[model samples]
Target chain A: MNLQVVYCNHQTAELDIRERLAFATSDQLSNAYEYLRSHFPQTELVLLSTCNRVELYTAQESQDDAPSHQDIAHFFSDFHEIPLTDFFDDLLERTGPDAVRHLFQVVSSVDSMVLGEPQIVSQVKEAYRTATEYEACGPLTHALFQGAIRVSSRVRTETGLTEGRVSIASVAVGEFGKSIFDRFDDKTVLVIGAGEMAEETLRYLSNEGVRRINIVNRSPDRARALAERWPGAQVHAYEKLEELLVGADVIVSTTGSEKPIVSVGQFSRIRRNHLDKPVFILDLGAPRDFEPGIGQIDDGVFLYDIDDLETTCEQNRIARGTEVERALEIIDDETDRFMREIYHRATGPIVKRLREQWHDISQTEVRSLKSKLGHLGNDDLKAIERSMERLVNKLLHPPLEALKDEAREGTPHGLLDALKRLFHIKD
Target chain B: MVNVNVICFLASYSVVLIMELMRLLGRSPVRRTIMLLFGTAGFAAHTLYLMNRSNQANLPPLLSSSHDWLLVLAWISILMYLFLTTIDRNLAIGLFVIPLVLFLIAAAYFVSDSSMPVLNVSNLRDAQQAALRRWVMLHASLLVFGIAGVIVGLVLSLMYLVQHRRLKHKQTMQRGLRLPSLAVLSRWNWWAVIISVPLLTLGLATGFGVAFLSDEAVPVSMADPVIMIYGVAWAVMAAFFAWLLTTRRPAGKQVAWMTIWAFGFLLVTLVGLQVLAGSGLDSFHAGGTRDSSGLV
Candidate 1:
């Protein structure tokens, strides 16, 4: 038996090449599965296509039937209608244990662009499910994907890989924003600018169930465009910033202004009546949209700038990095155990057949001896039958031991063939 | 069949407090489980000890004696701590609550263990004694509940201060030390004060009413040191509660500080007077003589 994977990821290929190679839609993935099945009928296949990677895994019952790296490259070239010269060098392949380990790492999110992300496991599951729907998955691929899922779950539970938020926006909203307010559904969210980080923070806050969002930006068109993406979000004139800030329970500021937008004097005036009410301010701007003194204005005004969040993000990054080593160790151990199970599965039938055949011969001889020795007592006959069984086990031990040792390295086809001919074992 | 005593549960709680402290280092599931085990063991022993004391005094634990009263308060605190910790494994409530429990139990050791003489119904006739006993039970129950609220308010305020400090400094929440948001803590603390003061006020009113109606030639009076001290504590708490109600947009940190002071003074006065009364100081609620005050 053979296992293999042909893939290109963010680490190996540029985005342009990866985009050209990715199967963006389910219909495209189905067509690719159909094309691979037609081209290589004896092989099992699963295709995983995400924004960061495009991977194709194949398994075959015999080593000779598996597709080579160049064959898969040609298939990609012909299927995606790209010349082989364009992406052939970027595509990489792994076979046997290496292929199994790569799949484990990918499912565990160790190979993700964002380390410790939880999406890759579900993506891998979806890819396997799609392959099964297309009838492209077989026993070897089934065991491989199932084992990968189990290993991923183990790594998640046993390690702190997914403990803290790593991104600046996530840390701002999840780490600090969540700790200040119990619920966000009733709170008003004010977005000061249309910067990318501000949009990301808005997304995080929106997911936390912020219903009312007010976006105020220098450019009305950009603010309108940002408002359209999330439901219930309204665009406002920049002059209404103070009015909006007065009502907002959560504020995300990412304007590109050269200086602070809301200074101590301005915020203090707005905060006069709302001193007791808590307001979370995430100032993601580089030049500090909210002044540093504003956080100290009152107990309820929680103002966090980029520097504050980056420190937390860096700490989270370091924590996640430490857990990566532990996750990799788990993945490596799981891979070896999976490969050993596969090898044992390949040699199982022959071992069972050899034992059964030897036991049958010993039973037949015992029956003949019992019939011939009619004067022997029942106890003596039982003892003689046990001796015959022991003799058969002794004679079968050496060949079985050799086959067992050979199965450890891989499937022992050479030893199996020799045993079949020498012992007259049938298919 | 085994003997249960104050020392048994006190040692168990001490161990549990040490385990709760270890949480500051980091989170460990095994350690949390063991801490809970110790806490549960201590609570069970405490319950048994209270039951034994009630049986010995031939009364309910709440009205038995000063020692039993203090232990009952500690018992209630442990019950809350165990319940909260069980519901949310990550809450650092035990760090604040268990120390107060330990303090209450330690205070129980120094105070009077003898039953209140005025509440001893065996020496008096059936009808009037029954009325006095019922009033005393009401007084003790109200006082115990009010103090329990004070304990809750103290813990919540402490949590608010710590959470406020961590947020102001922009430090990430420590592992195993997760607290509720400041809003939740502050709101709960406000309720704690608002509810406890009224209960305490009614408790004091009932105590005075029972004292005046007593059939003794010399009824308990305002001049009694214990009653005077309790009156002063109640006044302070009432003043704080009135300020709390009237103030619009009171800062959470300010409220937290005020709650700590008001509740802290009341707790010290309540426990300190009892200890002094136990050490043979002349007061209305002291144990031993039949002429002593009956009200808690």
Candidate 2:
């Protein structure tokens, strides 16, 4: 059995290259799998594409028929309509044990941008499920993926990497919100857009003792739904944002707009009304909800965006480097152990057929001897048969033991061929 | 069974503070164990010290000398710190409480050692003497509790600033220094202010009653610097309390910062004036008559 992976990750490629090469949606992944099956009919494939990395794992029973890195790169070129020269150098390849270990690391989140994030494991599971739905996975791919998930579970259970400050929101609130305010219970929390990020931030704030919560969204139903979920929270129309700003101590904005929702002039006018009371604004929107210049309005107002959180998250990631090393070592050891077990299973049929052939010849000889010695006493005849059978068993033990021991390293293909010739065993 | 001294507990708390600092680097079970051991040891010694002082003075710690009185305040803070830290080992409350403990202990060194004179007269009314003693005890108790509230408010404010800074800088919470959420801290700060102002008002009222009772014989003046300083501290606290009660629109952070400044000023003035009085720098002690038996 041969297992291989052709991939590009944060370490090997820039974000732009990864984005360009990524299978962005489930539909895209299904199309990629169809193309892979057409091009390499004998191989089993699973495609895992996430924001941080894009990996293609393939396994086949015949080593000679395994797809090359160039063939996979051409698949990407053909499917995405991007020339192979554009990103061929950025792609990396690993085969055999290394491929297995890489999948383990990816599933365990050791290779994630956020070292111990829980999202990558789910992403890997989804990718495998998608591949299975497309009939792209066989026995080898199934075993490999299952082993990777189990290893990931073991790593999480054994390590303290996920013990504290695990979420981006927790870090943001702990690092920035506490620094800006002396207390939270009395603070007015203004949530803009009522998105998931807004809810996450609000939950953290609510635990901090925020008594008043104001949720503003363009959709009144969304605002009311969010407000209804949290006690002491009030829903307001989007137009009341300026009025809410006048009383708000902390502002969390997460909208799905393509442009900044709050301009500099609008925020400055609100700031003038709020005066010396410090306001902490967390802009989690992709296109930036509040104008960047609002951060420069006054010292009293503290603003943070997604990129600002990266530096601190990176520092935390660095701190867990030792844990990452430990997780990787475990993955490496498990991969080797698993591969050895797989190789041992592969040698089972040949060993069984050889033993059956030897036993059959011994049985035929014993029956003939018994028939010829019919006049002898029953005990004497039985003793002779037993002695002959013991001789046959002893002779068979050594070769089988050697073959079993050799399978530990790999398939032992050369040793198996030699055994077939020496024993005159037929296919 | 070795006898523990104030120095022993003081040293223990100091070590605990160091452990708290070490926790900022990384989480360690050994460090946590050592911190708990030292904290518990310090609390035991602190209890013994207060008991010893109370027994020696033949009065409750609050009614004892100012030195014992200050020690009682420190004891309350330590109790709070121990309770909080015990429940949540991850909280870095020692960093906030330890410095306050050290300050209180240091201030205890400069406070007057002489006890409040217990006036005893056979011919005078027994009911009046009992009332006077009760009033004095009430006055001392109210002030201690009020001052304890101030300490809590100040600590919460400090925690708020630290938490805010971490959030603004986008720094993650260190493993061992986790603080209460902003909402919780703010609520506690509000409670601290609300509870403290009433206690302080009662303390001031009882003090005035004691002064009025003494005016018949002692020519006590309200313009005394100690009285004036205390009056100013009371006024500042009262103003803050009024603002808190009346202003429905103040932000929690605004209130937290205001509480910090207000409580900070009160603490400095109250401790400063006491130290000044003990140092014999004020006009009240300039006479050098050594009438340490005066009621006011």
> What's the TM-score of each model vs. the native?
0.87, 0.58
RMSD of each candidate?
4.4, 11.7
TM-score of chain B of each: 0.95, 0.89
- Model 2, residue A125: displacement in angstroms? 16
Per-residue C-alpha lDDT of model 2 across residues A174-223, encoded as one tens digit per residue: 66677556578878888988888888888888888988998889998988
Candidate 1 structure, TM-score to reference: 0.87
Which predicted model would earn the best TM-score? 1
Number of the top lDDT candidate: 1
CAPRI-wise, candidate 2 is incorrect
True contacts kept of 2: 0.35
Residue-level lDDT of model 1, residues A292-327, one tens digit each, is 999999888888899999999888777778888888
The residue-level lDDT of candidate 2 at B234 comes to 95
Tens-place lDDT digits, model 2, residues B1-296: 23545577778889988988897776666787898899888888888877876776677888767767777888899899889888887788889988999898777676675565433323436777677668778888999999999999999989977876665455666655778766577778889999999999999999888666544534457787887888898999999999998987566668878998899999988877767767674533122222332111
